[model samples]
Target: MDASNPGEAPETDETLPPDDPVVAPKARSIRPLVMIWRQALKYPAQVALALVALSITAAATLAIPAYFKVLIDRGFSRGGDIEGINHAVELLFGVVVVLGIGTALRFYFVSWLGERVVADIREKVQENLLRLAPGFYEENSPKEISSRMTSDTTLIEQVVGTTVSVALRNTLMAIGGTAYLFYLVPQLTMWMVLVIPAVVIPITVFGRRLRNVSRTSQDRVADIGAMVTEVLGAMKIVQAFNQESRERARFNAAVEDSFNTARRRIMIRAAMTALVIMVVFGAIVLLLWRGAVGVASGEISGGTIAAVVLTAGLVAGSFGALTEVYGDLLRGAGAASRLAELLHEEPAIAPPARPEALPVPPRGSLSFRNVSFRYPTRLESPALRDFTLEVQPGETVAIVGPSGAGKSTIFQLVERFYDPQAGTIRLDGVPLTSADPAEIRKRIAFVPQEGVLFSANARDNLRYGNWEATDDEIWEAARAANAERFLSELPDGLDTFLGENGTQLSGGQRQRVAIARALLRKAPILLLDEATSALDAESERLVQDALERLMADRTTLVIAHRLATVRAADRIVVMDEGRIVEQGSHGVLASAGGLYARLAELQFGATEAA
Candidate 1:
């Protein structure tokens, strides 16, 4: 459990359940908030400055009642001495000035720490997320993760910037004011102390309910975020299918669910606040009643009675503020626990310590020996079974198979996205697992069926394949890939902003740009997943020309469904049900009266007749 204040308990175990995808297992205590404290400690200077300011302001606030006591006893009681009254008033004003200055400084430093800490946390979480394997994403929603990065971090910011500061300042005031109350009238102070348990019991009981509801509330909000992202990203599909009403209904339910959860959370907090306030102030009213009796009997002086009332009120208000602070801390703990999960997630696919370096002067030879694999999400059916093949340097092998025949799986394995369950895959004779995944990828260039482009200008997107490529070298590759014509016609040439996923370019133009990117890579191995499958006849001809130039001196693996596209390849491999059933040239396969022959007959017959 987290100590009520920053420096209370030793650090507790931070381990959480490994498989909490929605919300972290409900935090039973604010121990998760200790993570935020550790992060804040990185800047000790700022923390020290903020603490100094907080202490000064707290002391100044408590000094106000003491000054009031003096103003009453020394100034007003002495036949209204104007000079003494003015002097006491000036001292009170000075304290007020000190309080104001300290508060401003405190705000500046704590807010700076909050923003800085959240920024560092975001960078750290994203850095770890980038290192995780794709399988992790398969198990977690990107939308929910995005919510964690934003919504959850905002809550952490509140804790660091506002809630924690409030907590510390109020605790100080409560302790100081209570001590002064004892000095004024110990009997009254004793009675108030007895009521402390009344206030504490409710906070402890209501706090548990609030913490559980807070976690559920955060999960509900994440669900709404995921829903909005999903619906907006698929708006076209929704309208085309005329399902807007259904989507709206679904979104409404999600929003309502979120609101309902939040309502439950606030209700619990409201009840806690009301109960604490009533108990605390009720105790203060009773103490003041007793103090009035003492004042009447001439036992307690007027100034003393006045100071006791003021100090007791300050103490009561501080205790009351604590209920809200405790709730905010619980909420912050929930947020911190979620982010900690992301920050501490170990990448399932990390580079091995002391990884073996690939051989120099890459030969581009790829060999998959009896590789059998299944996707993490679909383990019951293997995507590749005993998939054995070898492509020598400078060889172009086209892979043809029906959907789910493992053509794409071969590319995935080559990229080392997932390791095979059985058998070895090697690039140049080095087992892929032995070398670093980055080194393996640096030697291979891949162009998917749809050209994947970032939301960047043409120069950046083209240079993505080789960041060090010169402009002249980029143009040369662009010309070879037949992209120079349209690229030169682009409004700002290569500097033009290619909208999200290169939506600014036509299908054929994007494919050419992708080919130019691959050409710029100049890697020894190329993987093309039917680059021309989605283009029209003219576009296909242009992309085919570009692909031919790209394949000139590289060992290429092409996954093609259009039989006409792979006719001139050095060899063709036909797969079915995760196994290669046939391997031969297009001519040989056509004459063999096999699966490829039938597919070729259907596509070729249609093309020739057209």
Candidate 2:
């Protein structure tokens, strides 16, 4: 199948890291966090409430230090006045009560926003993923994509729920406390101001390094997740090959790599924290020493000294907290940027702005004209070379070819999964590209080599082909596909849960179920990809009978590997090296002694070829 345009470059090659899954682009800034901010803004009422509560809590926190100053000066230091002390104690209690209430509200609203925003983002990303063409998955790993959906979004949730709130609250405290410190003592405030530049410079330097490490750390973590999914999904193969030890070593290596990357990130964050703390609190100590001297000289009261000490501590602590939260914000930005890549991806195959409609009362005729194509991954060789064929309505044409001879490519083009680079394909006389893909596919039904079923009940799997099919209609189709007997014998009948990929059913039963699904589709055109190729003789006969019934009155295209399967086909087209070498009825092709005759001798013995 032509998975992508031969000339157009893949979208992932430009946006994603090259070759190495563990490598990631450096996070230059926190600007990518704006996407998260937009998602949070969707609930304005929650935002307003959270902000209001945060402000109230910050104000109340500052008020406590001021109240301490009042209590010391007017109550304890003023000849121990009982009434003044009682009044001060009561007011401090009131402030504490308000702070508790405000903090609770802030936590509630912010966490709600975090959960809601992540949920919405998941929905949007999955929706866009569904719209993307198969070409995207061919280029990118679904396992890596799954990690982004889980691990990356979790980082975003932490940022919204905890890091953002902590950063904002500390900012308010730092600014307000600084102003109050200045009011209390200009001399000390000026000294701390000089130390601010020292603290900020280290934060800026260490933070940049941290951002890069954090992004790489996330990539390594995603690599680990992808590796785990790959290994677990193929556990049976590993056990059969006796390669369990090798798989274990590979998983251990991935875990160690993830750990090493994370260690670098945390080390940078730790250094930033220690440096900012030493610079900020060292200045606070000097200020306190100066304040102590003033108290001894009677230049300032004891209460004034106490208030300066408390407020200065608050300001220094806020600066220290900012350094820690800054690291988390950068990590969140890295995650948001990765997710944004998927959310913003444009589908390479989409309906035209004004798509032409297919003709009603479907004629079911299909045609391919001078079609030449190559898969994007294999640009050196063509899958179909100048392929041209025409099928009349209600005719069954069987295609016979060796592996890589473009037999399946014909089905892919017919369904418009991809457009050929060099030719045009039409259905019912209308070009495939000119009409909406969904409308064109509605007229065709496909039954693949393996019967693909979802992890759902039998009824749901049957209805996947046509959701509106009634129970009576479903039973009728089941009978036509030779599936009614086993279905009726099932424990819950149609309601029975079919295991993943329908592992609960036998090979023949699964193929019959697939035929029943196509029967329910009720499309005028049917495409079968050797549905009974892997079945035993008895099973093959049953599936073949079911397929024959399904093909009656429908335009059918079948890829046949067994000579017996195509003997009844209206015409057999023999393909070799992506081109048709011969075309005729079974008897005529046998008499020609060409590629079909060769294939017949190999499958049906030399006597049958004659």
Candidate 3:
């Protein structure tokens, strides 16, 4: 592939960074663009108006040459009258006016259709992404997916809004101008039409290369986007380690790689455009020479020859423009196909056609029986093996374990974020698989280790758990979590905007806000996964106090690495590898002298011994 710029050299694959994922040949047929077109058809009124406007624009364009012919032969000929010439000029001006109006209408309708279609695609893609299982995300990066939603959708917008409109209008002019040329002089038109194959065959070949390069360019662009998202997400870490210079160098390399690929695609398209234009105008030149010969022999009039030239020029320009439009459509088709792939991805877990409803009065009981599972990305090692546990209604059961001991996996399974490879999980005696995921989630509240909060006001964040909660309910929940004081102290009290991920608040404040969110949820079951592990002692004590209040009259599951936090639970379950090694009160487990005893020694440090 040549570079997009005439003087630049083509970039080689060897220049790509080692970490870049090799782009594979995954684009399907043109069916994806067809799918997008189907969406455009949904707005029949806009499509119809656009088509009508397009016809007017094309017809007006084709009519100009006829009026020019009349102006030349009947108005400007030696024997022509001034009155006739003036009438012809008036007709020409009228055509220009009609053409101007037609062009504007076409632009308006075509642009509207493009925006509407792209908007629909973006909305639907986002809706689907939210429901896709975590396993899908594990296999794909979030940044790449986001790039598709933005960059790829923008490409589709260009096609629907501009490329398709230009192609359709040009097609009509090309065919119409050619027919008009025949009416003026068949002999010249015949020779011009014969030149079509020479240009088209070359376009067909180079266009394939351009399509391949375009897809690669898109992938490289997505790579750059993914890299930027990752780096920005961990900006604090990068700055803390003073890795800014290294990160900048890496990012520059990715950007350059993307530029090289894009340049190659551009060059291929440019070459095709130039080739088509040369062939088209060369045919016109040949026809002009023939027409001049006819006029020299007195067989053709000057006005007639002029009309033929005008129509031939239109035909040539239209054909040349088609080559460029072809390139855009191909690129857009590739983008549409990528988006289609995402849209068609079915979630790994889907609710049954008629999902069974949990018992009306919510019970917090949770039970896992003989469950075995491994993460999709980590298939070699089971995260949980033959794990069985039961937390009766209103009981607080704490799971204590080292990293990778299946502690958090218990919370994930309960949330139905994943399904175990074997055995069953049930809530309120109903098999989890039998109930809808949304319904099951409504009865449970989850607080992850890293408290999740969006960029919103304090009120909005608290209301996220219960969108319909009144202001008083929100205040009550905040007080319960000990977040009321800080929240009220914010610039706008409950209305203060939290930065991304609640960056405006301290670690403890975020935790308290998270607890308040869970508290507001008012669910019968609560999932706490290391919620207070990162907080300072004061914050931890406050958060723990909130947790205890939250646990009352609710079935709670806590995943804690610090055994001290779980010491007061009704029961403590110790897990190692993927199975439970011990289960009993902290005292019983300490006396049993197993994994729990050693962990207690490391954390609490043999309280009696001390």
Tell me the tens digit of each residue's lDDT in model 1 across 1-610.
2111211111232434544332344556687787788888999999999999999999999999888888888765747777877898999999999999999999999999999999999999999889877777876778888888999999999999999999999999999999999898988889889988888998889998888778767877777777788788788898999999998898899788779988999999999999999988998999999999998998988888889888888888899889999999999887787788788777766678888888899999999999999997799998999889999999999999899999999998898878899999999999988889889999999988988889999999999999999999999988877788888988999999999889899877888788789888989999999987667787688768777866878999999988889888999999999999999998788888889877887877734412
How do the residues 1-610 of candidate 3 rate in per-residue lDDT, one tens digit apiece? 1111212222222323323332123332343477678899999998998999899889888888887777777776777877877887898888889889989989999999899999999999899888887767777777788888999999999999999999999999998998888888987788888888998898878876776677777777777777888999999999999999999999999889889988898898888898889889998999999999999999998888888888888888899889989888878876776676577667877787999999989977888899999998799999999999988999989998888898988888888989999999999998998899999999988888877899999999998899999999999988887788889899989988999999999988898888889888989999998788767887788778878876888998888887778878998888999999899998898888888888888877787512
Ranked candidates (lDDT, high to low): 1, 2, 3
Please list the C-alpha lDDT of all candidates, in the order they appear.
0.86, 0.85, 0.83
Off by over 4 Å in 1: 1-26, 606-610
- Error in Å for residue 181 of model 2: 1.4
**Cα distance off (Å), candidate 3, residue 119:** 0.7
Query: TM-scores for all candidates?
Result: 0.94, 0.93, 0.94
Off by over 4 Å in 3: 1-29, 608-610
Tens digits of per-residue lDDT, candidate 2, 1-610, equal 1112212112232444444332234455686788788888989999999999999998899888898998888865747877877898899999999999999999999999999999999999999999887767887778888988999999999999999999999999999999998998988889989988898888888877887777777877887888888888888899999999998998899789889988999999999999999999999999999999999999988888899999998998899899999999989977887787788777767899899888889999989899998876688999999999999999999999899899998888888777889988989999998999889889999989888888888898888899999999999888877788899999999999999889899877888789789889999999989977756787678768877866878999999887788788888889888898999899999888888888888987888786
Tell me, what's the RMSD of every candidate? 4.8, 4.0, 5.5
Give model 3 RMSD, 1 decimal.
5.5
